[model samples]
Target: MFNYPPIVCHHDFSKSDLSVDTLPKNVSFVRPHLQTAWGEFSLVEATVQAIKLLYESENPPDWFILLSGTDYPIKTAKQILTDLSLSQYDAHIHHQEIIYKVYQENVKMSVMWQMLAYRRYCSWNLFSLPFFKDFTIRWGHPLLSKPSPPFSQKLRCFAGSQWFSANHRTAKYIIKFHSQKNSLTSHYRRRMFADESYFQTILANAPHLNLKNDDYRYVDWSTKGAHPKTLVMEDLPSLLASPCHFARKFDIDVDSNILDQLDTMTLP
Candidate 1:
């Protein structure tokens, strides 16, 4: 959205809707927009599917970013491009090692994040009883003969926000990893909220790539909930000052003026 650049967009929309779209000539949507919902593997599947298509396209992009319909850029396109032009990393993603065990209270993250990080990314879709929490059910079965976790000491698990930015090489790796029914993809396909960990684990495990631990997205998580705080007009100053290229979860119904203001700041 900075200057005229090729844009590939995808959504869980209908065929007619795709035909009626009003967008720049450089923009095109990948075929077969699959249906997905919150906290489902389909979310990761849809995104990775689009990435695969883009990677294999005749005119593959040098870089690609994963974003939602609600996400809006705060920085100008020139600024974003300039930052990336000088970057040394192959990917920019928000990431942290997931221990997949009972969390210690002294962890730097908040209580909610600790719980999420400590919780297992389960491939098994069964009810779990939260015992003393000293031990988690490993998101799979814990017993030796039972279903063990897909990851191990070598394939340590990592997680972060679902959104990320990657260059062509990294995108190729993601496509390669997802193409086969390996342990990672196999277990993550049935895991709860796979989108949040699927790409992250893949990116982290790649020793050949350099990655920055920042996703370049601003999301206010100060409010108490699974969802981040809904951005409003009052958050404009903070948004402008943040180093992130984009901020998310804004609602026009709540405050359309924020989008109007951001449009002015980000528009070329």
Candidate 2:
């Protein structure tokens, strides 16, 4: 559907289906070394490897978009390329600092504590008390204080959704940064949800990247819970109105008709 050549970086982790021999010519299947796990950096590592593989391919991509198996495009491949080509942003990623000021605006103080409920640095002792609990200290005073991040103050941290879209240059920068075992990377590897903060922290610190604080992916957070609400046939109207390149959290088993509608609908 695209005028330009599009290369897809697909990494399958399921044990049931490791073979990709029947995939389209454009899809490049990547092999991940580690199993999927929560609060682990393996997912982030696999993603970086996939990006590296894409860059090394014969027909390297002009843009790199991070997505999961559940994600689906809301716009045609041609439309996506045209929109990205006309834009000047180096990276499209949403970010917000994990501090009181940012969270206090719309979230209660209690909610803030729950968000950072896990102290990833303490993951070394899996058998110890407070194994995966947040850490707080008296700090020689009656009131408790939150522990500082493992990294030095020089490297600021930002948190957001893991998904992103970026030009090839930005993708190169991310891989380069990941290779170094600096305090930032070491600290992030131990983070509870490293996927959410790893790339955001890197891009936010690099001022020369021309970052835009939007990933152009529609995700509904209005519903209560950790995961976003799954898209259904009823959401087609809003999905199109979002003006986003993709909308995620779709399940083919639950509602495949939405995909049919999206495939046939004409963009205005």
Candidate 3:
């Protein structure tokens, strides 16, 4: 089994809010100071910094797996490390192509028209208007226009699912790419849901980061919905049956029992 160390990027909000006391010994928790007007950027910076520090230490792990606090391991850390070490691939999993038309119809109307219609309304109730504030926060710039170009031609595009694991070389490439591509990053910041799109487009388009197979994180998108479907207690049987190492969107508050079941079935 691969024996690389795990780095967990936890939010400062969790320290006082969540009840996580002792993580696994191999896991390193990095907490970034929260910054206003740059919710996701703070996270990105913190992760980049953590990676750079690890690289500089001369004792960096063989691979780095990026995960969120909401994510839980469906398989043992040993199994995940072992699988990655044995594999001969140098790729990240990303959607081949996103269905933009869906966004054009649902998201555009909700984002663009609502903005145009209620610009003054937003200004009137700055604190009270949740929808207006959300709209302005996400897509407050000119670049995120409707009828976005097809996935191939768009010099500046977006992709979904920011979760990924990469070798040290690829991690370095991402850091350099972000530094160099300021224009693209700025454009992305103003767009809605930049977190998902930013990383996906960058990794998918990069020539060196040949993301081949979807790094098998089991997400239940079975129910008809926009977001990836959430996992519940009933999904345990199928989740364990699958070979994926992790499953996500489990509610820590409500569905913790499922974790107990998984720990019994998958981990030693």
Candidate 4:
């Protein structure tokens, strides 16, 4: 039997069944309104919708954990639930003052270049038109930064892992905070790398939850890229030995062996 609640959010409602089929009996579906802004805005809308569903539910979940399509469990459902119950601390984690120098540098350069390019081209063709000038001036700044007072003080921010598990009260705060700061949140959501930085910063700044070690699944990051290294059959032994409850970036294609091994290990 499954020990915790599960909720799935899909970009496309029609494809929801694929995920629903894989979940155990306790899981349910919470579909977000289709918002196709990409990156941070998309994630913000998805998060807000998920929390709203919980608030409206007759019996809300004790906690909510976010996962991606690429994630897989390394521990049994029972083991995970048991571990969570024993902890007094809320599950949200943030690495304090984590340096994100590289990301900041890249964002500054990219923003500057985009502004220059848009001014050069759009100024002549688009801005020269009478009504278009006011429209362009009003909307053009949004392309630079939306809803505003930028999300973070740093030029760029590093988001270690996107996954998190938060108790119901904490989840409520996240939703409420965003609602009050809708303008600022909306602006930063359109900015660079806000997807990773926004939530991390908000949670870190929250008074209720303590920022500590990350509680979600773990994956080796020695290789380097935008994501953690995908687990392979060869990595099975080490993965099993690690205490992390989940690990991810699994290839849905050829990484089936790792999943097979996990099934045998966690289920048996």
Worst 10 residues of 4 by lDDT: 117-126
Candidate-wise lDDT, in order: 0.78, 0.72, 0.59, 0.60
**RMSD of candidate 1 to true structure, Å:** 4.9
RMSD of 3: 6.9
**Per-residue lDDT for 1-268 in model 4, tens only?**
2544555454546434354576665554555355444453666667667767766677787777777788888888888878777767665553333331222335663345444333321222223357664243323343443322433453222243457777777788778888785544755553544455567666765666755567657777677554568889988888778877788879958678889888887884
- Candidate 1 residue runs with Cα over 4 Å from true position: 14-21, 100-111, 122-147
lDDT of 1 at 110: 57
TM-score of 1: 0.85
C-alpha-based local distance difference test score of model 2: 0.72
Top-scoring candidate (TM-score): 1
Better of 2 and 4 by lDDT: 2
Put down candidate 2 lDDT per residue, 1-268, tens digits, no spaces.
5543545554445645566677678776565445667657877887888888888788777787888888888987778888788879998998776542333456853445334533332122234346656543312111233434553355666777889999988988988988887777876665566887888878888878988889999998668666889999999999988878989989999999998898787443
Query: Candidate order by lDDT, highest to lowest?
Result: 1, 2, 4, 3
Local lDDT at 176 for model 3: 83
Model 3, C-alpha of 194: deviation from truth (Å): 1.3
- Top of the candidates by lDDT: 1
lDDT of 3: 0.59
Question: Candidate 1 or 2, higher TM-score?
Answer: 1
Model 2 Cα shift for residue 25 (angstroms): 2.9
The candidates, ranked best first by TM-score, are: 1, 2, 4, 3
